[model samples]
Target chain A: MTASSSLDGVLAPVLTPFGPDLSVDEARFIRLARTLMDQGLGLAPFGTTSEGNSLSVDEKIGLMDALAAAGLDMARMMPGTGCCALSDSVRLSAHAVTLGCGGVLMLPPFYYKNPSEDGLFAAFAETIERVGDARLRVFLYHFPQQSQVPITLSLIERLLKAYPGIVAGAKDSSGDFANMEAMCTHFPGFKVFAGTERLILSVMRAGGAGCISANANIHGAAMLDLVRRWQEPDAAKHQTALEGFRSVMEGLPLIAALKAVTARRTGEPEWRRVRPPLVQFPVEREEELMERLKGIGVLG
Target chain B: MTASSSLDGVLAPVLTPFGPDLSVDEARFIRLARTLMDQGLGLAPFGTTSEGNSLSVDEKIGLMDALAAAGLDMARMMPGTGCCALSDSVRLSAHAVTLGCGGVLMLPPFYYKNPSEDGLFAAFAETIERVGDARLRVFLYHFPQQSQVPITLSLIERLLKAYPGIVAGAKDSSGDFANMEAMCTHFPGFKVFAGTERLILSVMRAGGAGCISANANIHGAAMLDLVRRWQEPDAAKHQTALEGFRSVMEGLPLIAALKAVTARRTGEPEWRRVRPPLVQFPVEREEELMERLKGIGVLG
Candidate 1:
């Protein structure tokens, strides 16, 4: 499966499950992935929702191995393999390609701020060259709000010029429609995934690819339906509903709120645990979130 | 030696030298460390000046081992060991303690933004517990401008109460004197180091520990002199000179400019190479910076 064909739908940035000891609950994680796949959603593991940066390299690899061991289609998975260190990025990206992952969501080296376009290009170039995998497809993750390192159009252009086949796509998590529209219009064939579900309908209508969103963990079917019928007469209605649910999710700590919804749905309280530098969703906030989610008919 | 005495006075946040291929110039690094020590300065490796976050874990360990092998006094060195991952921080901190280093300068787990105080405290707690060393002394690196995660006084109070010996002090790189002053007065006996040499005289006069400044890479003696004469009547004169040099350095990209100065002074152009996500200083900008420095009687 090529990168474009395999990853052209609503992909869920899956929430990682952790045990009481804060160790990754791999069994539960695999179960969650299988559940999402059964619902016809693609898997995007080790993303912002997955607390990918918090996990050690060994832990990330171990989780990926577990998913493969469970017999999931690797082509349906686009794991986030970016790291601050070039070697770490190279290691994870190579492993994903070897595992037959359709693509990898790559973030720029985020530690330093205000990097030059040449430097950003060099980082991506070095990683791709070092990975040395012909099958590697990189979807640049441009979430400047969090990473503080924006993947500018010029850098994208340079990467595309240098490695057309490997630099396949991008996810614009900047939450700016103009930027996403610019990406879609500027690169005719480049796959562009909306980072939020609220923008799914508009993105699909604007000749872009689907979204890779955190809310897809619970609302994948609704988002996928929007993607499938974006041209229909009542598409705006679905878009509005998604916007409502997304607003509720965004009103709280996104990762924790998503975990709360997953815990409630799956009857597994263990899903509520987040690694340090990320605390659990506060109990009162979770209660309020559940109320709002239920009011929007998302949770019962 | 205790963390307090060994890390006192002027400390240089050393500059890292990269070869033509951008691989770490380990021999040059060791030579610079030795030279700094000869000038009565302590070594703080793996700092923002050292591009600590850019280096891979193995590379960092290799450099630390090289420093020890060269018979430098580890007790006077406080390497920056914090990372976005808890395991990385634990490994680096533990290694520093085992190497008999005086202390480790740790940035809070910085990937997640808007984290709660509890979460930040938990991250430090987990790392300290995991390192499990009696000699581990952590000087919190509070550089909100870069990390976007500030280490507040309340958090410091909590950590000091919990781990009195381990939570040693902080380097206020926020460039906000008011915040640094709060740190000094709010917690008596806590070692506080100014991040910039421009603040060195005021920091010392306020009964804080000296400074760990990037300008120390080129002007260690000037800073040490100010530290020694802080209580004297002529202290302000030294401070004015240091401030003049610092203002010149601050006028450009700090890391690249420092590298440029080092290159010109040592007649080794290799000193100007910075890793990706940081390009080399532009020729025209370098010339401008050199002119400004010479006008200030710095690089003659």
Candidate 2:
């Protein structure tokens, strides 16, 4: 179950679960993986939704090992292995390959702001070179808005040319349709995944692989349907559903809110506990979010 | 000793030395710390120069503990503990306080770009609340240039007003003297440290807590002399020497070049291994840097 085939369908940045004490709830993570997969999602855990940045390197590896041991097919998994430090990134990405993950989604070394496009190329190239695993599939994770480090088009071209097999595609979380369009057109055969659900159909139209969205945790079936109906005559309905979900998450802490909903749904109230500095949804915010989720009629 | 007095003085953002295998060279770190302190420097380790961001949470804590155990006085130490994660930041800041560190220089939650000022306030406020350590002297580390998240004047005011005792001061690494001046004037009691040595004279005139500089690693004595004799009629000579040393570092990767110089002076060539993504000084750059250091006549 190695991820040898193209990642050409719906994949969700799976939500991470925590116990009431905010420890990684391994049982819940496995259950979430199984549930999302059953709901037709290819998995990308330890992503933004998973608070990938929040987890320590050891914790990330532990979660991945847990998933693999639970027999989740690696081909369907693309865990985020990016970190500010290259050593951590390499270790995570290499371990993912060893576990047969279809690909490791690598974010640019993000701590250094406005790093030259050349620096980014060198970082990626060196990591791929150092990993020295021909089986390694490198998918660039572009979330410039959050990272404050843009992965320019030129760097992507340089990487693809240098390591054709290793640099497979990108997860474009830039939130700019023009950038998404540019990525799709500029790089032939490089699979581009939309960062958000709002642009799923548009991204699909622009030749994107699929969306790796945070909202897909709760709206997995609908998101999958949205991708499926991209070419359908009634495709506008899918787009509207995505917009509704987007509206709920806008101007709020999307990750925090998403975890709250998932916790309630999965009968694990403790899963609602977010790590510090990212407080749990206040009572009013939680109620409003729950009401909105019910209105979307996906609570079932 | 607790830092009851102003943390004024020429504080060097000391560089960390790693063995060829990239493990922490505790001997080099201690030697460097002792040499700088002997030359009248206040110590600020695990900062941008020390590749603090590259270190894991445990590594940072260990470095702090090692320095303390090496007889580095807490009142003279200002460790860089800023990170993207809140819990990590809290742990670092809290531990520093417990160890009686002068203050923890904190970078904001940097992964998320352009976070609202309110969000920034929440982050700082939450950290102080969670640490709950009165011994803590929090210094807002405003390195907008690197963090990509600027701490605005309004946010600073809000933080100061809300947590008067917790928000002690700030280190403005923005390099804009006017901003530094504004901070000094606006927050009269606030200890403001200029990030670079270039503004030492101006910042000093503006009631600023002397410079917290990267170049101070090699220029400590010269910078201290200038600070000590700012009122001396012959202080211009000291200022010129300081500026010359600054220009040398400005020509190279400031952190790496400082480590190289420190290693050379201390006869520890192995002290120059920066962590991954930040490669070592090329031989040519090293030679060029050495020539500048020699030309400045600051080194034998």
- The positional error of residue A67 in candidate 1, measured at the CA in angstroms, is 2.2
Among the numbered candidates, top TM-score falls to 1
Could you tell me the lDDT of residue A104 within candidate 1?
Answer: 95
For model 1 the local lDDT of residue B210 reads 89
Which residue pairs collide in model 1, if any?
none
Query: Each predicted complex: what DockQ?
Result: 0.74, 0.36
For model 2 the local lDDT of residue A115 reads 62
In order, the TM-score of chain B in each prediction is 0.97, 0.95
lDDT of 2 by residue, B1-300 (tens): 123454678888888878665667777788888888888788888788778887777777888888889887878888988777666787888899899887888888777666667668888887788789887887888888888888888988998888776677888999899988988899877888888877777887788778888888877777777676677787666666677677666646666677777767777778677765566666567666777778768786
lDDT of 1 at B1: 14
How good is model 2 by TM-score? 0.85
